[model samples]
Each structure stands twice: as structure tokens, then as C-alpha cells.
Target: MADIQDFKSTPKYETFSYLPPMTPEKIRRQIAYLVSQGWNPGIEHVEPARASAYYWYMWKLPMFGEQSVDVIIAELEACHRAHPGNHVRLIGYDNYSQSQGTSFVVFRGK
Candidate 1:
């Protein structure tokens, strides 16, 4: 007889999905890296159930030419406030490459 599988599978999202939840300090560091790389930052949110969907709702226009990590964090907080039950993610868009350079979940919905 074949052996039976006993483990369950979990869905993995964007960057850092395999790691534990990030702290505020860690998040700030990530934002700083984004700024240092000159990549535009954007926020998007979606319900936990629909997190695997192809699209998410944009919080606002990407912060172009903004170098302040504080500003980015504030915007992320605001998006969380507006969508407390949604999974929120921060994405870094590379203008030169015209593609997304980094993406990670900043907040997980209940």
C-alpha cells in the first residue's frame, strides 16, 4: 500500500511569504530600501479570501519622486485603516525595467 500524506498545504503570497510577519522596524527598512533603489512605491489591498486573485485595489497613485520612508509608512497605515479586513501589500516598481522589482504583504487580514 502507498503511504498516506498527512501534511496540509498553505498558500504563499508575495515576497517574505515564507518568513514570519514583519515588524514595524523591518517594514521601515524595506521602505528605505525601496527609496534607495529609486523604485516607485505603491500600495494595494484585497480581501484575504481573494488574496490569490490576479488584481488588488490600489490605495492611491504610486509615490513618484518621494524619498521619505515616513511618508510611505503613513500611506500604508492609512490604507490599513480604510481596509481593516483586507490584506495589504507594498510593491516597488522599477521604472528603468518597467516591471515590478519587489512585492510583499505588509498587513494580513483577519
Candidate 2:
């Protein structure tokens, strides 16, 4: 028999999701935290039925340094509208290391 561990599966990335989904207010708070940490925020999404579903496409340019919280919220809304039946996520990039430092699935639309 093959090794059982080899048959097991794992997620491609570490992504956090809000159970019961997050309200707009909660999302704002989370974004606020990222901004306070001096991280850049960006959005990405993937179609549920697509092959290699784990792969995500960028929805907007990364916002770095201090930015208008409302703008982030607006972008989030636009992503939701554009991909009403897909999964959308938010990622925070640390400017210093130039890598993704935090991420979460902000929407799960079916």
C-alpha cells in the first residue's frame, strides 16, 4: 500500500475565513489593523469551478502606506460585484520584505 501521508491533501496557502461571514464593519476593522501595521492591501479571487482553483488573480493594485480606508472598502465591494459566484480574498503585503504577510477570505459566494 502507498504511504497514507502521500494520499492526504493540504491547502495550497494559509487563508483565514470568518465563520458566519464578516460584516462590513468587521472587515473595516481588520483593514484598519493592517493599515496600522504599515502593510499594503490587495485583493484577489478565483473561480470556484476552475481547474487549479487555488490560483488567484489580482483584482487591484496593492495599496501601501497610509491610504483611505473607504477606498479599500469600495474595492472590496467592486470585487464582490464582479465575482458574485466566486471566492474573494484580501491580502496584506509587508513593504519591507515585499511578501504577503497576512490574508483572509472576506467573501464566499456560491
Candidate 3:
């Protein structure tokens, strides 16, 4: 199980497996995990594996201070590497302010 309590406890490389055919329970749990970062999902949609697109809407999770991007990249990369079968790909990024963290990440998963 992914320890949701470990968010602010000094993030480290971690493995996360979002269930195939993404279940409601799994999605809910993932939302909860992001909530630790002050993220709240407003919309979430999934398409078939053919298109390689996934979109999620989450409330702005403000990020203060520097090095936030590095931390997120490290974690996402680690999780992707750990689960080779899951075709994880970063699709887009949009952020207006460092203090106003992004709550959503558009990714492709197989």
C-alpha cells in the first residue's frame, strides 16, 4: 500500500501502481494521496488504451518555495521505472505560479 502519510515526511523515490481498468476505489485512493499536497479532484476521465491520454481536474495545490518540480519529477519517474509494464508518459504541463501548485497532470498510461 502507498503510505499517504509520507507525503510531507521528506518525499523519496516510490512505486505506485494505478490499477488497470482503473477502479473507483483506486481512483479515490489516488485522489486522497494527492489531497495530501492540497489537491482536490474536480474531474477525472479515462479513455481506452489506444489513445494514450488521461485527463484529470484537480484544484490548485499551492506549492511554496523552490525545488518542487524536481521533487515531483523524481517521484513520478521513480514510480514509472519501478512499474515498467505501465506505460507512463508525461503529456503536458501548465503552471502559472510556483506558489500556486498544479493539481493536475496529464499523463498517458498503458
Q: Rank candidates, lDDT, best first.
A: 1, 2, 3
Per TM-score, the best of the predicted structures is 1
Task: State in Å the error of residue 8, model 2.
Answer: 14
Candidate 2's residue-wise lDDT over 10-106, tens digit each?
2322334313346778889988998888889998888766514447888977765657788887887799899898777888999889887888877
TM-score for predicted model 1 compared with the true structure: 0.89
Q: Could you say which candidate leads in lDDT?
A: 1
lDDT of 3: 0.36
Task: Look at candidate 1 and tell me the lDDT of residue 30.
Answer: 93
lDDT of each: 0.88, 0.73, 0.36
For candidate 2, the per-residue lDDT at 18 reads 15
lDDT of 1 at 22: 79
Per-residue alpha-carbon lDDT of candidate 1 for residues 50-101, written as tens digits (9 for 90 to 100): 9896699999899898899999999999999999999899999999999998
Tens digits of per-residue lDDT, candidate 3, 66-106, equal 23444544444554455434443221222333232333322
Clashing pairs in 3: 62-101
Candidate 1: list runs displaced more than 4 Å.
Answer: 1-10
TM-score of each: 0.89, 0.75, 0.26
